[model samples]
Target: MVSLSLGELISSHRSRRNLSLSDLAEMSGVSKSTLSSIESGETKRPSYTTWKKIADAMDIAPSTIINAFVDTTYHPKTLEIVLAEVIREGWEALVAKVAIRYLESPRIDTFRALDHIDGTARDTENKRIKRILCDSIITFTRSRGIPSYLASALYERYLIERDDFSRFEETYRRGKELLLYTEHLYTEDRIDYYYKMGVHANILGLHDESIELCRLGLREDRTDSKQKASAYISLFNSCVYFGDIHVAAIYLKEYENSQYADFRKNHFRATLLAKKGQHEEAIELFRVCLQEAKKEGRISIVVDLMASYLEAGKTDELLRLIESEDQFLPEATPQHPYRMKTLAQYYRRKALCLISLEKFDQGFHSLSESIKYFKQLGTTSEVIDGIRLFLRHHRTNNKNLSFKNMEILEDICDNII
Candidate 1:
């Protein structure tokens, strides 16, 4: 594959759109001369950021531009990393298409490449990749259209985050209808759907729903102990969320009976123990998770452990996490939405920590960036309690939080002003 000549590539798209030099410059924030220089080959090495802005403004992904620029590889060099460009930019569809194309490639990691943390982008392209995976699995079941159950679940979550109860309830009802009556689902197929449904519920703080889906999947799953163990893990996690140690213990026992005691499962088991007054055991489990996370270079897991430390008031472990070299991938790369996303998570956590320490002014800056993250995902209300509680406990002068409770946070929750 020959790289597209800068002139040919830019000219094709620009002329195709009847866009003028100034028009492209305004759209991409590149100066006209630089744009001209690049097109005329006077500028051979444009910066990734500048080139990326041009690609994004043209509504083309880096991979597509790169494909035409350089030889296309059997393995994907870049995957489309979609972030909300404007307040109204609708990426649900763009993302859907990207996954379809990515999955078509046989050499794609298929799992690791799609592993994204929520609220930020990553060079690994994980979150969008996760969404793509879920969407693709369902597409495998539903055949390439939007899955209503997922759409409804996501919309309901979106509404809940915004405190839009009236419509949220309505969407939840609608989503359930689509989910239950979903046609063309094979019994073997529904197991993973149930797992994904549980994940969606978990994201919305709906522990019961997650537990229920996990149970459903477990009940129906026959072929794989791995899936059964996963469902049990979900149930155990839900129990932990509601502080039901009795059930959590039972699930842990069952997990022990089964052969699924990997570090990943053990990590959650540790958090459960740590939070349930078994500090020594919990800390040990956390250390295990920390080691595994470090070994695998899973920053997301590291962040989770760090968050657990923060919640557990384990200052030492939390600080260690803060100093990580991969403090969320801030380097400018063609794989952007994946880049700054980790930085977003890093900052969000830092802000929460700052707020917890009563550093109100600095806390707000970090928190504000954190909020920008949720806002991008159409998420706001879900994190309000955390934000408000942080503000309540730490706000030096505002002192708006009445107690570290949901009621006050819910009342105070509003989009950024």
Candidate 2:
């Protein structure tokens, strides 16, 4: 597509705004002589600060002011020149929209462009705007599965939100690395990081680390309901994981009036019931939760309900639940992280059910499949757990099974890791 020159863009916007060179100079704080030089094509590459002042004076994005100079392929160059300006002028939201639009172009290396913008804005003084812009770029990168350090942190958050514990240990470590890049993280992002890392730590059996992380999130000020909800949920779960039911209950009560109280409250209440040995009540609550989650089409919760049922020894019911969901095809979209996670857990649950029913061969094959899925999913922790689970069941059920098959399953699990 043919594009206007930077000089033409600036002159056109200035004319449309009905501002003379002197008037523009007065509004933008740029000398009329320099404005004339830019508009007349004498100053071909005005500094970012100058372009920003003019864009601000014209009530336009710096990108709009210089769009003529930025083709789809040169979009990052535009960002590199003005990201700091965009942040300093509190135009993060506007510029982020522009950047996202540029990302939609198929010819661009969008991830590399975002990375470039990040690097260019590294020294920008406004932390709040920097944080906002950082979140935008990282969020885009994460949703597209583009690998970058910040995007990886958000990906871990995504995994935790989906209740995928397959990589909890690695997630915790990566979250620590994420902390080192905190200069550009907003308060909400920090809260999200702490709570998510806290959950991962809790899953890794690092109770103290989890508690500290949750406390850090709670200590952040000006948190809204959703943010506070996350912190509270993290604290409650951490306490429960540590067997501090009293503390967990206290945290739970603290959020009883939350907007999320119904689903969140009931889910944890069921957990508390299970912990208190009220199996039937817990199972009933989970069944209700399962129905609600299904009605809402909450796949993560559905998968979680399957795990809860299996934990409660409702094997047949769990199998039936899995079978009933046509949407639970884990192998359908391997590129989708949530589906892949669900697939791993789905097969793992199926294997456990088969083993319990003394379907030894089918159970071993399913276990092998689960381990393979977890390995392909790059979750070392899940792979190890799968191996240990196989070993435990194999030891118990070996006499009733073919020795060669067991050996093959062991080799399959071992070879993948």
Tens-digit lDDT track of model 2 for 122-211: 545565554555566666765785554464435334433334334444545655756655445676666777776675565455677878
* Candidate 1 weakest ten by summed lDDT: 115-124
lDDT of 1 by residue, 1-417 (tens): 345765667888998899999999999999999999989878876654666788888887665564443223234444433222210243444455544455455676544433321122222234434344454434433443435433433432332322332233233333453354334455755666676556445544578988887777777776556766766666776787898988888887777677765656676677666666676667667667666654333444555566667666788667666666364333432122212333446567777776666666576666655555544433346356447545555454655544433353454354432
In angstroms, the error of model 1 at 369 is 3.5
Give lDDT per model, in order: 0.56, 0.65
Give the TM-score of each candidate.
Answer: 0.47, 0.51
Residue 272 lDDT (model 2): 84
State, as a TM-score between 0 and 1, how close model 2 is to the true structure: 0.51
RMSD after CA superposition, every candidate: 15.7, 13.5
Cα-based lDDT at residue 11, candidate 2:
79
Error of 1 at 243 (Å): 0.7
